[model samples]
Target chain A: MSCWDTIADYGLRSLGIGERLLPRDNFTLCQQVTLIGSGMIWNVYFGTLAMVSGFFLATAVALGKAAQSPLLRKPSEWFIFVFRGSPLFIQFFFAYFLFLSLKQTHPIFEPFTAAWLGALIVLFLNTAAYSGEIFYGALQSIPKGDLEAADAYGFTGWNKFRRITWPTMLRLAWPAYTNEAIFLFHATALVFFSGFPAWQQRGDALYYASYFADKTFNPFIPYPILAGYFILLTLTVTGLFGLVNRRLNRHLPQQSRSKLRLRPNLLR
Target chain B: MLCYLTTGKHMAIYVSVLVVLVLLAITAVTALIFGFGGAMAARSRFLPLSWFGKGYIAIVRGVPDIAFFLFFVLALDIGFEMLRHGIKCPDWTAPIWQGNDFVVCPEAKLPLGNAPQWVHETYAFFLAVLTFSIVFGAFAANVLYGAMRAVPRAQLETAEAYGMTHRQTFWRVLVPQMWVYALPGLSNLWMVLIKATPLLFLLGIEDIVYWARELGGSKTPRFTDYPHGDWRMWYFLALLVFYLAFTRVSEIALDRIMRRLTHGQATLAGEAQRKAAT
Candidate 1:
């Protein structure tokens, strides 16, 4: 087959759409690139969905964590700690099993046993915990003067939070949150690797990359393609977050506006 | 094997925990070594060395580290076998890359085909440690590099004015002081390292995650006693509790160590310590 036919055959293979069986022998560079690129669709889907949903959940969690009442604060603290303390790999295994067991009891959880929903839920919770911690840290570190100023303006309760607290917390947390988003994108790679079965051979980027590697007995090519896709994904995430960060800090003077840096050490 | 330990098995569970702790300790020490080397190289006056160091540190920035773990284990294993095949089986003419199979000579096989089972397990574990060290080392290098820079230039200048050589200044003045700055990052890295230990399962090592899945899976009547139907949630919950307790203890221990490390240092932590002491 020509490279175009090869692409047509395997391009959407990761979505379990175009191809049934993977290339067995004579695995071409084109096939590797095309299939791995197709696998990136899953990565994008998982990352985008988990991140978008996790964003709102994270804000609520951060607020809960920052709340004064123990009723609210304790559960929030425990949720963040439990998720953040454990490995994402372990969390995937645990969640996958939990969903499987739940499915045995109730048919409603049957969908949750699949990688798409099961792994997404795990990724969502994981990111929420990490981002919630980041947001909480930012919330705590928001200047006392900022709150005092809001109080002076007679902004109280939810109004005080919605107007004054939330924006400043986001502005302060933007850099760290950007790092968390990138990490979450990277973490979507782990779902397929974990216990969540890639039903119908529908796996993420790492899955296809590993498939090519296994078939070709060469790790050099496919893995780099996976890394390349991730690099682009990371860059895109950073750019998007940076745009939001700029808007968050747009009111502040240029010197005071914090630049969103991609910190390498923020991996977990 | 202890009878009272548990009805199913306790030794494997305990051994898994030991493996995790060992991996953590070894990875931490070795990664610090790699990080220190990378940091010093990055800070070197030589351009090439600095670029290599910077490149090493920049690697983890864009890529997910799980990719590194997956890629490097296979790559490193092949690399070791290839080197051995070239040296030990020099007379052999068959290509190592024979179509799809990596046909290294039997003698060149890692742990050798005839080696004991423990040797194979040990070799795999060793590769995991090396991979973890290499990956985490990059993060540590970034932290250490920043810490090195954060050590005030004035301190180095003062050491120079004291007639200390460059090596003396670096070893005596810079290294000692940079720890205060590096402590926070290093502590964070330590937590990340603890969490990352479970990835060892992906490297094909039988870690706690592996055991949890294996022991928790449904067992048939043909299988011996303790037959259960998908007890994975419980096993994983146990694993979760194990990790949570481990991290909690680590947090306390690390906080205490930080207090010790910052007792008389010249940073905000130290200043606070001094104030509290008085």
Candidate 2:
């Protein structure tokens, strides 16, 4: 078939749309590209959803970790440690199995077995922990002067936190949090690799890329395609985060605003 | 069921833990070598070498490392086999790349067709180790390169005034001082390295993840006496706890080492130490 035919058929193939069966033999470059591009939809889906939800959860976790009460602090500390210390790959495996076992007992967990929900949950927790750590560090590092200013203005407790603490913590954490988000985005590739099956070959970008590599016995093409897609995805994430970062620093004068440069460090 | 635990295959699961540790140790050493070389090359006067080092560091920035892991293993395997094919099977002219298949002569096959199973496993393990080293080496190179630059320029100039050669100054003055600057970044890389070990399962090794899945799968009564429902959750939970404890211990140890390393250095920590000593 022509390239257009391949795109038409495999454009939404990863979502189980046009194509019922993947190209088994005589794989074309277009087929490889289209299928892998289709698969990236899942990566974008997982990364965006997890990050959007995880931001709020991570903030809550950071607050809990910094809370005065042991009741809140202890669990938050342990949650951060458990998620941060372990391999995310193992987390996915464990979560998938846990969901599977739960499915055996409860019908509500049936949807959780699917990669969209189950793997997303694992990614959610994993990013929350890493981002929570960043925010917690930022929380602790928030200048004492800022809190004192808030207290002098009669901004007590929740108001103090809302006005002074949360914004500053986020500003301090944004750079590192950007790194964590990118890391988590790259990590969505691990979902299919875990025990979580890519139902009906509807996997992520790496999945389609690996599939093509296996079928064609050529690693050069599909892997780079996947890498290129990921590169673009990471760039987009950095850009989006940079925008939020600017908003976070809007109150500061231009001379004082810390420039947001993407650092090459792994997740903090 | 008890006999299964005693068998070699089952025992291999526990052995795989050691395999991971061995992989970690070997990868750590090799990655340091690659990183050092990369840093040196990046700093070299030669343009090509500098470009190569820069490329090595930049390559990790955009791509998901799992892609590299998957790609390098197969590419390296084929590369080795292709070289052996050209050298060993000169007379055979059937194209190695015939459409979709990579059919190398039997003599060209790694470990030879009739070699023992352990050799094959060892070779695979070696490849996995190499791949891990290469990927992580780039990250380390990035860290070390920055650290090298972070060393005080005055110290290097002082070494030059003392009539030390460039190489001697680099070794004695620059390298020693760079560690203090590099420690935080390197420690972060080490944690990342520890977290990355589970990807070995993706490389198709019988690591802990492999064992967890194999043991946790539902075993029918017909298959074995130890029939059990799917218990992968529990097995993976054990693996999770093991990793958490390992990382926690590593964190504590690394923190202690940082204090020791920074005892009299010029960093903030060292300044704090000096004040406390006074």
Candidate 3:
């Protein structure tokens, strides 16, 4: 079949549209590309949703970690440690199995077994822990002068945090936070490979790429195409984060401001 | 039943941890070698070699490591088979990549095609190690390069004034001093390497993740004498605890080592140590 025909049939295959069965024989480049591209929609969906939601949760976690009371600080510390210390792959497996066991015990929890909820829960907690650590470090590193200035102006408690502490914490954490965001996006690839089953053979880009590789016994094509798509995806993530970083630092003098540098050292 | 947990399949789970450790050791050595070479190349006067080393670090940075992990395993397998086909069966006429089949003469097959099951497992483990080394090496190279630069120029100049050659200074002064700066980054990388061990399952190595799924999944009487419902959650929870404990221990050990290394040095950590002691 021609490339156009392949696209027409498999364009939305990942969503359970247009095709019932994947092309088992005569796997064309177009079919591989189209299906893998279709699969990318899932990756972007998981990454974007998890990163966005995780951002707010992580701020709360960081604040909790920075709290004066040991009651708040201790739990937040352990939460961050548990998630940060373990593998994301294991987290997925554990979450899936936990969800499965929960489903068995309570049929009402069945929805939690599916990838939509299962993977999201894992990614959300994972990102929150990582970003929480970054934000916690930033909170500790916030200039003491800023807090003193707020206190002198009679700002205290919520007002002090809102006007001075929170903004500065975010600003200080922005660069490292950007790195955490990109890693979270890349990590979404692992969701499918983990214990969570991709319903209806619907999976992310790596899944479809592996499928094509298995079918064609050719890795040279499909894997590279998937990598290409991921490269573009990473570029887009970097661009979006860079824009936010710029806005966060907009008030700072150019010489004093830090740029969103792509330091790969933040992996994991 | 719990009886199955004491059987050979359970043994597989324990053995998988060994596989992970073995991969860790192999990847560490190979990545260090790769990192050393890349670090040296980046410092080279030659523009092309420096650019190539720099590019290797840059490209792997943004892309998801899982992408490279998947890509390299298959690509390396194909490349190896093609090499074996060229050498082992010179008289064979069949094309290597025909339609969807990568058929080589039976003699050209990796692990010799008819080798024992253990040999095939060993081969897969070897490939996983190589892939990990290549990916992590770039990160290591980046850290090493920065550490090398961070070593004060005055020390190097003093070495030069003493009539030591650049190579001698690099080995005796620069390399020794660079570790203090590199320790934090390298320690973080070690944690990443530990977390990455689970990806071995994707490469077909029967690591902890694989066995957890296998042993945890629902078992029927047909499959085994002790049938049980899915217990993967518990197994993975056990794995989670193992990792957390391991990382915590590593963190403590690394902190101690860093403290020792920074003792009597000019860095902030050293100053803190001095104040605490007094």
Best candidate according to DockQ: 1
lDDT of 3 by residue, A137-233 (tens): 9999999998998999999999898878988998999888877878887898888999789899999898898898888877788878887898788
User: Best-fitting candidate, measured by lDDT?
Assistant: 2
Tell me the fnat of candidate 3.
Answer: 0.78
| Residue pairs in candidate 2 whose N, alpha carbon or C atoms collide under 3 angstroms | none
Residue-level lDDT for B276 in candidate 1: 93
Model 1 C-alpha lDDT per residue in residues B1-278, reported as the tens digit of each score:
24434754557877888998999989999999999999999999999999999999998778888889989999999999999999999999988888878898899989888889999999999999999999999999999999999998888999999999999999999999998789889989998898888889989998888887777778776865655577889888888888888888999998998889989988787899899989
TM-score of chain A of each: 0.96, 0.96, 0.96
- TM match of model 2 to true structure: 0.96
Q: Which stretches of candidate 3 lie above 4 Å from their native place? A: A1-5, A265-267, B1-5, B220-225, B274-278
TM-score of structure candidate 1 = 0.96
- CA-lDDT, candidates in order: 0.89, 0.89, 0.87
Per-candidate fnat, comma-separated:
0.73, 0.78, 0.78
* lDDT tens per residue, model 3, B101-131: 8898898888896899999988998899989
Deviation from truth (RMSD, Å), model 3? 1.9
Against the native chain B, each candidate's TM-score is 0.95, 0.95, 0.93
What are the DockQ scores of the candidates, in order? 0.74, 0.72, 0.72
Per-residue lDDT of model 1, residues A26-110, tens digit only:
8888988898899899999999999999989999999999989999999999999999888888888888888888888798998
Instruction: Tell me how far the alpha carbon of residue B7 in candidate 1 is from the true structure, in angstroms, after superposition.
Output: 5.8
